[model samples]
Target: MSSSLLIALILLLSLLAYWLGCRRAVTLAQRPSADKLHSRPGYYGVLAGLWCGLPALLIVAVWHLAADPLLTRMAMHGVAAAKGVASPDQVDLLVNDMRNLVAGNVVAHEVDPLIQAAADQYVGLQRLGDLALAAVALATALGGAYVLLGRIRPALRARNQVERIVEIVLTLCSTFAVFVTVGIVLSVLFESIRFFQQIAPADFLFGLKWSPQMAIRADQAGSSGSFGAIPVLTGTFLISGIAMAIAVPLGLMSAIYLSEYAGPRFRAVVKPLLEILAGVPTVVYGFFAALVVAPAIRDLGGLAGLSVASESALAAGLVMGIMIIPFVSSLSDDVINAVPQSLRDGSYGLGATKSETIKLVVLPAALPGIVGSILLAVSRAIGETMIVVMAAGLAANLTFNPLQAVTTVTVQIVTLLVGDQEFDSPKTLAAFALGMLLFVVTLALNVAALYVVRKYREEYE
Candidate 1:
């Protein structure tokens, strides 16, 4: 069974068990002071449900995760040994084929008797596993309920115990979010460390070239690809520059108009209209960039006596800017609206025009938020992939010109990993290294933005 289906089945059964348990517990004996119970009957039902599902879910999760990989490995090893395969790597390929067969993903014409046998074995084990899981789960839930029932005497602090259990479960669930982030960061860090073992981290960070290709055939000497990230970062900055050029003025002005100038009726309409820019799918933006925006820019540049590549950084950046504008304006608009009414009145009372008061008082007061929003935009631009892939050229040209074709780290990472490349190859490793760089850059931007917002924020009236 799929993990999700397993979970759903377990939950459905647990809920049913909980209701039955709750009914049994409540009717076990009628208390004269039943109304004096610490919690309502529904809370008791929820408590029963929690006890039934939570521990069993935890046990199942731990067991499946720890054992599934081991089982798969043993199966692969057994199949390999049976096939008399000498190279472990060759065995792994056969194992993949076997898995595909079991999944029914392989075409019928290609299905051999060996593959069919493996698939049958896989399906058999899955059925046994499901049956075992169901029996164990039901038994555990009943056992827990029976024990809890005996303890639920009139004097027992059942509510307190249930609440404590809930607190622990909630804490564990929340910590998974932190764990996921740390896990990703650590994986990238370690892989990047491995990559740096092959190439100097300094060269990767600051060198002026970024051709990540390595030869596939064993004795073919060719141009050594430099890991200098200057071009990718240069292109990243160029794209960001063009995006910011498009986003900042437009977004900030929109915010100023929305917050300080627009009346309520206008605000109601314009805010969502501005935010609608954010709802457009990034892939749609990518298509627009490739089909419409890039060609228009090239033609426009040609008319203006400037050479423009059809897949220029400007087009992607501009489209990305449009994507980021809502992020900037919405955040800045909130901060602007949060400014003290008294300050605006004071500025106006000093014989300042509405424009002067807004420019001087409101904008400066909300400047920190604006800066944060801009930093967010910058990070978004750096990490953007689809638009750059479709619109920005693949050439890792270290050019400052927005009209020129250039590439970013995300685009390079995509090109490096896609297709049937060996995982141990430099081409694949380059992606991990680029990912580390991207992580560091975004991390720095986030930290700076948070610091700026915190430092300048008017926290109290």
Candidate 2:
């Protein structure tokens, strides 16, 4: 049976166990007296389900984790005995070919009888492993259910035991998340180190050029790749700055008007419409920017006797700002509304007008949240790829002029890593270096934002 089907059977059995456990506990409490069961029937049922399912799931997980490596070893032995000794790369290629043969994919090289035998062995072993896994998991689950059902009694501390299991599961989930994040950072850091080994850190960081094409063959042109990132960095900052300039004021003002000044009827009508902007796909926004906004900007600039590229940072930034508007407005509106109404009343009692109360007291109290909202908008702007790629041309221009075409770090990272390329090459590894730089900058921004929020957060009694 398939593992998924087996797992589904285990879960069905667990549900049966849960029902049986509940029925047993209720049967034990037939004589309803003042002194009754220690734990509730629901707790007993949960405990039974946990006992029946968790062990079976663990068995399934262990088998899955071990099966691939064991099969690979067996396949490797058969191939080696047939093909003689081989290097690591050759072994990998042979294993890949075996896998292709097993999967019915066309093999790159000529196939032999030994390779066909190895492929057949791989398939047979996989089927045998699946059968073994199903038998073991079912037996373990049945045994766990029998033992736990036998132990179910009026005095069993089922609630405490179930709570402990829940806590452990939650802790494991949290630890898994932390480890996954650390793993990503470490993977990027290692690849970035490899990239830096080929390109000098100073040259990569401070150089004015941004070309990353390196010729693979001797006769190929443009063998020398420029690893300079200054232009890319400047373009990213310029576009982000323009986006923030457009987003912050409009979003903040919209939030302020919606939260404080607008009446319930108007807010009820407009707020959902405003938030709908967030749900619009970014590709849709990119299309809008490229087709509509870019043309309009080019025409307007021409009328004004100014030179503006058809694909300019200005168009991308404007559309990106519009896209991020809902983020800022929604968050700021919630924060503004969260400010205690008593503060406004106190300001009014001190002869302050509504605007005065808002500007002097309410905004001060909500400044931290407002700043956080703005920072979120800025991060969104920085990480944007599609709108910038479509509206702003993918030129890593150093100039800060919004009328010119520009690109971002994410765009360059995408450009460098899009095609099939060797991971060890500087051209491909540069993507990881760019990714590491973006990660570090984002981390610093988060740290600074946290410091600002904590340093200035109002302590209201």
Candidate 3:
């Protein structure tokens, strides 16, 4: 049976166990000589369900993890013996071909009689393993349910055991998440180190040119590629700066108006309308920027006798700012609303005007949250890929002029890793280096934002 079907059966058994446990608990509670139950009948039911499902799930997980590799190794050993020994790479290729054939996927090479027989053997082994797994898991679930039901009584600590088991599961999930994050960071860091070893760190970091094209052969034209990240980094900050300039004022003002000045009817009608921008896919925004905004900017620049690239930073930044406005406005509104009404009342008691109270009392109280929201908006802008790719041309120009074409770190990373390229090449590894740089920049921004929040955070009794 498939894992999903097996899991479904286990769950169905658990439900049956829960019903039986609950009925037994009720019967015991009604008995004349039975003492009061330590926990509720529902708790007993839940504990029985946990016992029924958890051990079965654990067996399924462990079985799959251990069985797949063991089966693959056994199949590969047969192929190696039949094929009269092969290199590790050749053996891996054969293994892949065998598995692909077994999975009904396209194989890179023609399947001979030997590989076909091996594929059949592998399939037979998998079926046998799945059958064994299903039998063991189902038996374990039934056994656990029987044992727990026999032990369930008035004095059983069902709720305590259930809570402890839940706590352990949550902790395991949290630890897994942390490990995944660390693994990603380490993978990127290692690849970046390899890239820097080939291309000088100083050159990659400080070079003005951003070409990453390297020739496959020594005699090919343009074999030397520049890996300077300066232009890309400049474009990133310039576009993000323009986006922030447009977003911060508009978003903060709209938030203030919605939270403080606008009446309930208008606020309710308008808030969702503004937030709708956030739900629009970035690709749609990209198309809008490319088709509508970019052309309009170019025309306006021409009318003003200024040169504007067809794809400029200003166009992308403007649309991105519009896209992220909801992030700023929604969070700021929530923060401002959370500011104590008592502070406003006290400010009014002191004869301060509404504007004065907002400026002196409410705004100060909510400044930390406002800062946090703006920081979030800034991060969103920096990390945006589609709008920048569509609106801003991938020229990687270092110019600060919004009218000029530019590219960001994310755009370059995408460009580098677009096709099937070998990771051993500096060209491909450059993506990881750029990724590491972007990660550092984002981390620094978060650190700065945290410092600002801590420095200005307020307390009130």
Candidate 4:
């Protein structure tokens, strides 16, 4: 049986087990001489279901993990016996062929009779394994239900058992998240170390030029690429700064207006419309930047007798700013509205104006959250690539002038890894280093934001 079908069957059995267990518990309670049940009837039902499902689920998991590699090994052994002394790559190809034949895909290479026989064996073994798995899992689940039902006395702590199982599952989920984060950090760190070994930290970190093209051979054209990352870093910050400049004030003002001045009906109509900007895809924004915004900016600059690159930081930054406005406005709106009503009432009773009260009492109270929102917006702006790629040109010019063409770390990382490139090359490795840098920058922003939040957080209670 398919795993999905088997799971559905197990679930149905568990439901039956739940009903029986509940009915038996109720019967025992109604008996003249029986003690009152230790826990609720629903707890008994849940305990029975856990017993029926958990063991069978474990069996399915183990079989699913182990069955594929085990069957592949056996199949590969058949191929090896038939075609003596093949390389590891050849063995893998033959194994793939066996799988393709079984799955009815067109085999890419010539198929031998021995390989065909092995493919047939693979199909037979897989079907047999799946059948055996279904049988064993269902039997285990049924047996567990039988045992648990027999043990379901009036004094059984079904509630405690169920709670313990839930606790373990939650703990596993939490630990898994931590492990995943640690794995990402370690993988990036290791790759970055390899990158830094090939290029000096001083050169990559501080040098002005940003060229990453390394000659494959000594005779190849172009100077063995400049690994200096300063230009990319500069462009990233310039665009992000421009974005934040446009986003923070406008977003904060919008939040203030929505929370303090706008009536409920107006707020309802406008807030969702404002937030619609956030839902727009980045690629759509990219197209807007490239097609509409860049041209407008260039025309404006030309009218003022200034040179503007077709793909300039100003165009990308403006679109990115528009994209991040909702994040700030929404977060700040919530934070501002969360201020205690009593604070505002007290300020009003003291003869303070609404504007004065907001500036003195409400804003100070919501400052931490506002700061957090801006930081989040800044981070979003920094990490944006599609708009930057489509709007800003990929020339890594180290300049802060918004009218000039520039590139970012993310853009360069994408550039470096676009085609079939050798992993060991400094060019490819540089992408990892840039990635690590971006990671560190984002981490630092989070840390700084946390520190600022804690420092400025106001306790109302």
Candidate 5:
């Protein structure tokens, strides 16, 4: 009676219900005195299937959601009453241990007889609950199918019911997505508020140094960490700027050539090959940046008598730019293709050359989309963690020199939260602050890009 097994059984029963309903509808249609069937046979089948499945799935979801807490409460109550464990915190700990033991996960505390008994009880309760759940779900599915099949007459409006169910499902999915996004933003915002309470917002935002190492013990020799974000933010923008510099020109030019000049066969073959770079894992790009690009940049810098760190911003930015080129080129190519041929035809009729037509007409029409693609590429570059971590050394130096080593905000976030961390500490909470900063920065970028797009779109219109 595992949940997956119950779901499969319910689906199978729904399929049977669909077949029966369709046959019933077909039989009704064949009657000499029956009016034309209200809807298609498929609609009748679908309506029956929905009736059979939806109630059973709802029961299954509610059962699982309520079962674990109820079982935990029942088990914990017995343990507390028998053992006189009155403290709330200790009860919580014991509950966790019992659940962990039941789940076969390692428990923090050594298992005692009381915990063992409670775990066994929890398992027994879970098994009994699963059995009940299976029985109820199956009966409900069968009952729903029977009711719906009996009601499936010529005027039943099966199609309308099915469409309504689908619309409700889609609305629920959209709402769930919005809630998840809001949840993420609120969680990060709350943690960042906690972090800012510990470290002054001014110091965190405007301080020059980026050290986040806080001494655990008062007597420890380490300096209390400086949460200055300036260096980190500088490095982020530096690398992202370099990446955009490389990505935009090359990606846009390649896109223009492919869309406007290249032959159909060449464009078809080369575009996929170009887009394959996007499909390659970021880690692979990281490795290539670290092994191949970094050394090459350093060697070239040496030949030019310039100082280049072994892991420099230039190397990471260059590789990141190459990795994101497909994001820009593929999207730009599509946007360019989407530009109506009438614009180009009008330009040609006005005696404009191909280059003039593209510059004045095609590109203007596609400007908004091109800007969107660049914005996406910029976001990709900003949020890239693996390539920056691999190629750029983790030094928060406030320098604009691409030859020097620097680190990004994403790298800092990952570094700060790498291991087990007490969330209350400013050191750990700093990760949330950095995340919030990134979120805000990206939002600002989107707003700016949108403004540019709207302005240009109005001009063209």
Candidate 6:
């Protein structure tokens, strides 16, 4: 069972035990004052339940996360004391090799007998941790019940204890998400730093080329791939801008129509149709871009008397815009609906027409939420991979014209790490650097969006 589910089962069993104890107490004491006895008895049951369950569950969570890395560390130390591997790099290499062996992988060198033994020890230690934790949790829950049953007699303060336990349990659940997000950010931050060591920060930030080549064989072709991200970033920004141009007006208008204008029957049909865009696989969009959209864009450019590449930015951008329309519309609609109906009634009573009330009152009230949706859309556009990978040319063009071809950070990251390649090369490391940049950029977008939503929400309130 998942640790979470096991924890839940333990808590549930404690609750059941508390209920049985409380029911028995009530049956034994038949006094009228007993119905009023000790905060209605149910409170006593819950209090006992919380006392039995909460502490051990917290320990289990801490144990699960700490177990793997701790055992790995122990295994690393074991290997360090072994016969062959002595240096730091060698230790790291041995760890990786041992990991591969456990997964039934072929290692670089013939496997050392001692290192293999150490790998077995790590796995065994992890199993032991799991077994020990389960035992401890069961023991603690049973022990807690034994104590709480004694305290369940009349005159004990049970309701307050139950409430306090509820508060702590809720806080623990909420903190879990925050902890996971922080862990991910720290992991990415460290990996990115390792990558930046291979290529200078300034060079990566300012360089003009992006062909990351591993010079494995003699006389590898092409100028060493420019790791400079400006061009790809420009492409992402340009295409995302184009996408927003198409999506915002179209999606928002559709949202306004659906939420404010469309009848129930029409909405029932159209909302699903709009969301169907989201359900469509991006890879399918890629195919459509390559087969249908690219040619159509090229022809339109031809009619406009402008030279356009077969694989152009306009095609990818438009397709991406289509992909994101449902996201913006769905979010905007929910935010608009969340606005108070009394505010709308006041606007209408003041002789505001439907359009004017919606524009001036509802939109202003929902502005923060709308801006959040747009920021989310912008982030989605930036991180989008398959459509850009197939339709937009892989060449990183520094130009701004939407009619011409351009690449993006996500696409390049995909190409950089697509095949079998050495992890030590600048090419591979560059992917980490780009990923870090992408993460940072998205993090900023989300922060800005949330800030806008918070400020405006306060204004509305």
In terms of TM-score, how similar is model 1 to the real structure?
0.85
- Alpha-carbon error at 298 in model 6, in Å? 4.3
Q: Report the C-alpha lDDT of model 5 over 1-461, residue by residue, as the tens digit.
A: 78899999999999999999999999999999999988998899999999999999999999888998999887766787687888999888888888889989974566778988889988999999999899999999999999999999998888899999999999999999999999999999999999999999999999999999887667777768999999999999999999999999999999999999999999989999999999999999999999999999989989999999999999999999999999999999999998888889999999999999999999988999899999989999999999999999899999999999999999999999998887877889999999999999999989988987888773322
Candidate 4 residue lDDT tens string, 170-191: 9989999999999998998898
lDDT tens digits, residues 185-240, model 3?
Answer: 99999999999999999999999998898885676786578999999999999999
List clashing residue pairs in candidate 5. none
Of 2 and 4, the candidate ahead on lDDT is 4
- Higher-TM-score candidate among 4 and 6? 4
For candidate 5, which ten residues in a row score worst on lDDT?
452-461
* Clashes per model (N, Cα, C within 3 A): 0, 0, 0, 0, 0, 4
Off by over 4 Å in 1: 1-6, 13-35, 39-42, 70-87, 106-119, 142-163, 340-357
- Which residue runs does candidate 4 get wrong by more than 4 Å? 14-37, 81-109, 112-115, 217-223
| Backbone steric clashes in candidate 5, count | 0
lDDT of 6 by residue, 33-128 (tens): 664466667777777777678767767878878886788888767567656657888878778877887677874566778778878887787777
The better-scoring model by lDDT among 1 and 4 is 4
lDDT of 6: 0.83
Q: Rate the local accuracy (lDDT) of all candidates.
A: 0.81, 0.91, 0.93, 0.92, 0.93, 0.83
lDDT of 4 at 10: 95
Winner on TM-score (2 vs 5):
5
Q: Output the better candidate (1/3) by lDDT.
A: 3
Cα RMSDs, all models: 3.6, 2.2, 2.0, 2.6, 2.1, 4.6
What TM value does model 6 have? 0.77
Clashing pairs in 2: none
Q: How well does model 3 score by local distance difference test?
A: 0.93
* lDDT by residue (tens digit), candidate 2, 254-359: 9999999999999999999999999999999999999999999999999999999999999999999899999899999999999999999999999999999989
